[model samples]
Target: MTRHDPALSTPAQSALDALRANVAVPFERARAMPKAVYTSPEFAEAEARHIFAAEWLCAGRADALPNPGDYLTMQIAGEPVIILRDREGVLRGMSNVCRHRMSTLLEGRGNVRSIVCPYHAWTYNLDGSLRGAPAMARNEGFCKDDVTLPTVRVADWLGWIMVTLNPDAPNPADQLAGVERLVGHLPMRDYREVFREEFRWNTNWKVLAENFMESYHLPVCHAGTIGGASDLNQMECPEGEAAFNYHWIIKNDLVPLALAHPSNTVLQGDDRRITWLLAIYPALLVTLTPGYFWYLCLTPDGPGAVNVLFGGGMSADWCADPKADQHFAAVKALLDDVNVEDKGCVERVWKGLCAGMSGPGSLSHLERPNYDFARYIAGRMP
Candidate 1:
């Protein structure tokens, strides 16, 4: 089988071939991925087809839609999708486009009794079945029961709502069993989501994803907020698993809330201050700690833009504290500051990647997760 597709533009094929070559060597000798992989439109399109469309992507947490009518909308590889809970208390994924005339049915996140189209009054039940259509009685061929919205695949794995355009994709929970074994004692599903925000950054999605995969840049890029607390010599970057990659660093006293709460008996000794950074396959990036957790779900808007779903919250132990509100306020402030620093760093890298003289560089030992991520990407390319 050929690594490059014949239909791909010459530049895209060449870029993908370079990426494959970059990951062919052992991790200790691996170099950085070629610059073209982040700047090629054709290559991004190929990723949309083979990776985003074929794999399960995180859609925030299931707790976001607690009621039957609560729903949220997002685009998966350019296809608008709705994640909602039906009256039967079942979570579902469905087309967000109206069945009548293809107009979008919902916007952002909110609770609705039913999905009503603004264009022509087409209504749909929470389960995505066509409820009613105005002035359609005269159309002899129009059957309401036969005009329901199409269903998409959705699943709740460890409190995260995961969706996929491909029906043949493996179950996320089954594929991520390794992750469960690592963090299962923490009760990840019980963590409450305190805040969720949407953002668009001036950088490639892969750039941001790779940034989250490795902590090598934390000491420099996030110097103002989190850098001083992270010790490069203590960062752990083990070989990545098939479904995800992770690294851990012990928390310092910089932010007291980052450590385990006094009431958190689950994490003892050094585990109390350990912070885990996890990159779940294609797009979910998470930072899990003993007291709080935050995550980003990434999707590419184009070669130069990335759409992000950013959210975080405290663990049940911290939330039950008498000063829970104060603790969370401090955590949120720190996260916002860290994001500002990251935005500046990644965007600058993108600007450099666009330069004519820019190209691949050598990988650091701390970048083991990045090399694994490159291998995953190359494995999915045409």
Candidate 2:
């Protein structure tokens, strides 16, 4: 399918080309990252270099490392890595592969004083330093420093743990200025890590992102929840950075034609636009409704599997009354359906991308948000 994908949207050609026409952007960068970015081994490797290994990637929330020594194990750009809070209460990320023999050091998130690899009984401190060895001194000319886990770079922004697999990655604080300016005053950080699970997806990560860039698909795919409230006309992304912030606001349920303001004359069933779902480039999406929030982290496992992790957050006073409680429940249920629908669509797109029917494709006239995302992707490439 073309960039618009019937259910999706894209920006006008003139407007998009204008933003990208700057001589600073190489021709290859202006063009899409190419079909290989979504389907080929080479493109994926390049992304791993410029986007994952070299850039600060959001891994999870600070709460994952709440207490000292708590840690979360995840893969960044297909590299097995682990994030740990040392005894001093600082967060650090290191390659998860054991330094001695390449055994995985940890799996999932948990509390551990010292990570002792089950394979050879080698141990690493919370800060990723070599803490113990099965029989290191007995080996010929083996230096203890050489056996320490290779540390990756890490930075925490607004509670999200970011890992940079490339040792020479830039200062994350500087790299995130654009996003920081975009969300400066929003009450976004008041999130709690209440939920999470990983799903293996068979589609390109971008296809999944396109699914979320706008509410155009609400009226069709999510008619029961979001389609009931939001429509194509009211589904506008905010201006400038807000458009890329991946944030939205809604006051009603996801019912079709649901009214934004439910007065006495407004029917309860009218779906009228009361939700915001904003995504960061590569893959991270946040959904903000009247009283609830949902965050999705889409980490590409490989060309074949993408890890989609979901979590729920809410206001401090969500339990104020029965109505607030009810709204939260409804929001969670609606999002569940959203995930079900997205899974089917992306799986199909993955099939199409792998089929080689198309190489790299262009943007649709109405999908400006995606094109904007494309702009960010191009800027990020080395």
User: How accurate locally is residue 20 in candidate 1, as Cα lDDT from 0 to 100?
Assistant: 89
Model 1 whole-model lDDT (C-alpha atoms): 0.91
Error of 2 at 218 (Å): 1.5
The best candidate by TM-score is: 1
**TM-score of predicted model 2?**
0.77
Q: Model 2 over residues 267-354: C-alpha lDDT tens digits?
A: 1331234455667545667665434457777776655667777777554344343465466566567778888887886687678777
- Deviation (Å) of 182 in candidate 1: 1.5
**Would you list the C-alpha lDDT of every candidate in the order shown?**
0.91, 0.62
Query: lDDT of model 1 at residue 320?
Result: 91
Worst 10 residues of 2 by lDDT: 1-10
Model 2 lDDT on a 0 to 1 scale: 0.62
